[model samples]
Target: MPNDHHNAPQTGLSYYGLSLLSYLRESHPDLADDADFIRTRAQAAAEAYSCIIRSGGSRIEAAEEADTVLYRGLHFSLYGTLANVIRSEFADIIPEEDAREAALILLPQAREVARSYELADDFAATPQYALLYTELTGTVQILLDNGIQ
Candidate 1:
């Protein structure tokens, strides 16, 4: 059979990174400025993912492998760095308990958002994508507000 996946619109780590950067730009401009960092991680993860697919690994296996790469790269860049920045710079603004809670809430949600982009060809164009963006931003805003006073 022909390679249908090739014909389909790009749906992989690189596009997922861009989608993530777009979301960060809207919700967290500071992180968005780290585009080079994000792109490098995403590119490395994408290459690993493609290699698995080319090696005839099952889609599930490939995705699992990709997830490992993403966790080490993308997850660290976004969440780990955010945590460090918040703790170092804004620890006075946010309480330890609230920061912990926010991490618990946002980490999985953010992973879901990234997974959506990884799997969907045009996730950004979908209504659900908008809803996800709103929800994620709202959560961040609420956390910030709670921290303020």
Candidate 2:
């Protein structure tokens, strides 16, 4: 009986949820490490701070807050994964710390550039959006090349 270990509840955490929780844990280590805290309080802090049921802000404001949370969280996760991959890929030539530091520096700027992209007047055109998209891609390309070189 003491050695049996088959009754544990499974928590099939999704990629997005895990990323959100990872960010919350990194930003607020003092918070309790539990599903209840993460789902209600920590999640609200990361994903609902601007749209609390009693906050009384406009719907647009709440939507913006949600967008901010989702975008930033995705960016954080993207950087984290990229750094890990770069470090592993260039293990012989690049130190893990250096690769991670480079990623940390570039990710925010890349995210800003990405968010700046917007559609042009024509339905099929996205000149400004394409420019920003290329800029972000070039930034990442530089990071990847330099990371390996």
Candidate 3:
């Protein structure tokens, strides 16, 4: 730590974080392409592994990067239970399909419906955000596999 009257703390942003944002930006069209929105989002996300591979980053790293942003974006207040589950089992996994699956099982039958409410009206509404949410969704699957859901 450097403390000087003339020098303030240095400033910088994470390239990985920026890359996560970039990956998120890529999801816009995918969601907007759906007729109902849910299917569109799911499709876009289902194919995220392929997309990230072509986006100049490994799918695992890309997914992890995206997840990192999500863990921060929602202020760690959302998906807490599901997140714990993911970490418990597939903490080493990339996007975490297990978690995503778990969330699906709970959604439409429970009150854990934050994506449609907290994010946009649907996936088509916010492309980048939707993509990020998808990553989070996969993390939920990881949790489900871990018996979190």
Query: Which candidate tops lDDT?
Result: 1
Per-model CA lDDT versus the true structure: 0.54, 0.49, 0.42
Enumerate residue pairs that collide in model 2. none
lDDT of 1 by residue, 23-55 (tens): 554344345556565676567767778999999
Candidate 2 Cα outliers beyond 4 Å, as residue runs: 1-40, 43-76, 88-93, 112-138, 143-149
Query: Which residues of candidate 1, in runs, are more than 4 Å off?
Result: 1-13, 19-30, 73-149
Candidate 3 stretches with Cα past 4 Å from truth are 1-104, 108-123
* Model 3 per-residue lDDT tens digits across residues 96-121: 65654443344433234445445523
How close is every model to the real structure, measured as TM-score? Answer: 0.37, 0.31, 0.21
Candidate 1 local Cα displacement, residue 113, angstroms: 30
Q: Give the candidates in order of TM-score, highest first.
A: 1, 2, 3
> By summed lDDT, which 10 consecutive residues of candidate 2 come out lowest?
3-12
- TM value for model 3: 0.21
Candidate 2 lDDT by residue in tens digits, 16-46: 3455456544432222145554454335444
Better of 1 and 3 by TM-score: 1
Error of 1 at 95 (Å): 11
In model 3, the Cα lDDT at residue 78 comes to 32
